[model samples]
Target: MSEAFEQYERKYCELSANLSKKCTSASLLDGEQKKQKLSEIKSGIDEAESMIRKMDLEARSLQPNVKAVLLAKLREYKSDLNNLKSGIKQITSNSLNAAARDELLESGMADTMTVSADQRSRLMASTEKLNKSSDRIRQGRKAMLETEELGVSLLQDLHQQRQSLLHADDTLHGVDDNLGRSRRIMTNMSRRMNRNKCMIGSIIVVLIVAISLILYFKLSK
Candidate 1:
């Protein structure tokens, strides 16, 4: 709450209370004095209404939560002001009837300081309802926050899972490459072994043919 707004709201409440007192007390005066007091109260009522409007604008400028609370209060104040406005009109008209005016003043003066039992009960009920509404709004906000946090956590988990899958895929590809290289090395070793066996067979056949020729030549001698 801005200091200026609080100050002005206090000013408005004071102005309203003073106007109410003046309206009730206006009956105590004579014809000329009563007329003057009613006129002054009328002017004060107008000032009070203007203050309500200014406070409404101030409430709009507040943060969302604060504004909600202030606007609710401003509405209550408006209702009270409207009641005062209506009462003033009735007072103005009734002032011409001396007897009726006297009766109203007697009752109004006492009622100013006192609330009837029913009225107090209703006021308490309204306050309780307002508190319940506030609690529900707070609970809704908390739920939304919790849901948002859960969504963020899920997204993080999903991202980590995707990264792990990609790493596993890379590992599989590396193993496949190593297997292909080992297969090629085995093929080359097999071919070299076949060539060595063929060369050894050719040398043995040549030795056998040379030894047969030496034995035939010795028999001829």
Candidate 2:
């Protein structure tokens, strides 16, 4: 009976140690997974920041208010992402240690229970933060997309307006040139008509004078 009790105790200890190690490893895996998720969220935020920067530059060169709004949005997203990062760090660092593991393990199969509970709590908190970050990033992306579309439409409208104005200007200039040419031709014709009238008046005056003198001579004879 004594020997049997000793064997049972040894087996239980061995099982406890194995279970505790497995739980620790599981916790470690959960931490790594959360880190990966955090990295993915950070990547998304970075991409959004880059897009916002590009939009801002375009808006600066093309539109003022648009640039300002986009820049402001970028700042807001960056701040939110920083908060998410802080939360992730806190959750990941609350890891269970060896003493806690051994005590929980020896407490009759509660080792797995305690470790699982801790892992679940940490995972849940980190996952929630990561999800929130993702949601914000998605929202930001959507807003940027809308902004880009609006910008493109505005640019197209401006281009069309410029083209129309240029065309109208060219037509007006052509008409003005034509009117100037017509005015010059009319002026030249008027000057020629005045000279011809003067010449005809001089010839008529000389003929009248000659006829009157002939009549006078005949009468005197």
Candidate 3:
């Protein structure tokens, strides 16, 4: 595993330890302070939970024994996180109930109001519809964002490919220019070679004619 993963694991462990300590000490505080402490601990547990999950994913590349140990730790962390969340929910429920009761007593209205079954059913149905519509809207927005990102990435890749092609074309042009110059030099050398061959042939013919004339004159004398 990477050092970053190890650091995240260590941070999660430290946060879990701090959360445990905070939970133990929170009961000693007064109402508002206890709620505040619990909130802080809940935030820490949430952060730790995220880190633990990330570590769990990162641990897949580790040895089997190490992965098993990390998985066990992840499961323990998850259980603890669930417990912390349940505790927070209970605390919030209790606080709300306490506040409502106090307010009713202070207002001299101890009676509670109850909704009819039909009304409750209708309210639930309306809330469900609203939630479904919200979820659809959220999903649509997420898809649009993903598509936009993909398009941008594709455009960037295309731009890079175009630049590479242009570079290749320029290089080919340079090669063509060099080849043309080489061909011209070869043509010039061929012409010069032909001229030199002709001059050498003429010199040999003149020397042969001079030797023949001298031999004929000596024989005749």
lDDT per residue as tens, model 1, 1-221: 55666777788868866876675566445578878998898899889988998889898997775576567667667766766676666555555544453466578743533334433453444345434443443454455446546655766797899999999999999999999999999999999999998899999999999999999899989
Stretches of candidate 3 off by over 4 Å are 1-124
Q: Which stretches of candidate 1 lie over 4 Å from their true place?
A: 1-124
lDDT of 3 at 208: 93
lDDT of 2 by residue, 57-137 (tens): 543553464455445544554554455455435544544343455467788656587676866776666556555655665
Candidate 2 local lDDT, residue 27: 34
Report the number of the highest-TM-score candidate. 2
- Cα lDDT, model 3, residue 14: 76
How are the candidates ranked when ordered by lDDT, highest leading? 1, 3, 2
Instruction: Return the TM-score for each candidate structure.
Output: 0.44, 0.61, 0.43
The prediction achieving the highest lDDT against the true structure is 1
User: What RMSD, rounded to one decimal, does every model reach?
Assistant: 14.6, 18.1, 13.3
Model 3 lDDT-worst window of ten: 113-122
Relative to the true structure, candidate 2 reaches a TM of: 0.61
lDDT of 3 by residue, 42-148 (tens): 78877977897788777777766456545654565566556555545644554565567657767977644332343344344434543443344345445544654
In candidate 3, which residue pairs clash?
none
